[model samples]
Target: MSYTPVYFSLREFVDPAIFAARGNNCWQLLSPEILRAADWLRGIFGPITVNNSYNGGRYSESGLRRWESTVGAKYSQHKFGRALDLKFRAPVTPQQVYAHILANQADARAHGITTVEDINSTPTWLHIDCRNWADQDVPVMVKVVQP
Candidate 1:
């Protein structure tokens, strides 16, 4: 089945990367499952702007390194292809967004997400991934290293 590319509002931060990945000015390239999770979040939050999605190959190396140092993983869901970093529109702090994610954490997990982070100890953004696995009721990595 052919999949249609859709833009999730939360993928805005990952620009240049996401756009360059596609020939056209695409926002994100998500699988059906990932799209569904995006849609789910949309329904819960009225409307959200995408922060980043599908980093362009050009930025892959640098982006990967940054994510590894920040998120710490050679193969992040975002790198392997099944995750997104989300944040609210202006006037919305990361903490507020984190609250939203935490509020709906249960429902989000049901859609096959296995990881959700408030983006380091700073709580700058929300990182969510769809691993095609059942909701395990706990984050894959919960070691919060506060700075």
Candidate 2:
């Protein structure tokens, strides 16, 4: 029932319909890296509402497409359970959070943070992921301002 330890619960990550279709076996099947990313994001930004009314974090397969169709890159880390878009409560900006992670990237690495993004469309939430990456040889940092 939480986003850590068992980070990908059906009630949280999977949409109700998706969860019903696939059943519970896959509900808690998120990657450890994804869990670590959630942990890292929590450490940097306190009290994030991942599955609240805001819909700030994890998305089911259908959920991802429903909200992010315009963004393209359908097969994003999110679909593969390697990414999350998180929003902090207050007193935290995307720039500040990004810099915080960048400043302490070595620490952030353990939490599987290979990529950090600030989509200008919604600067409050930071999109973080590692996709198929298995090492930290080169991390990708991008800032996209959707017009």
* Best-performing candidate as measured by TM-score: 2
Residue-wise C-alpha lDDT for candidate 2, range 47-74, written one tens digit per residue: 6544442255343342222233444465
- Superposed on all Cα atoms, model 2 deviates from the true structure by an RMSD in Å of 5.2
- Highest lDDT: which candidate? 2
Residue runs of model 1 more than 4 Å from their true location after superposition: 1-29, 51-72, 118-122, 132-147
| Overall local distance difference test of candidate 1 | 0.48
**Per-residue C-alpha lDDT of model 1 across residues 31-107, encoded as one tens digit per residue:** 44555666666565555545423433222221212333444455665655466554555676656755665666656
Each candidate's TM vs. the true structure? Answer: 0.53, 0.67
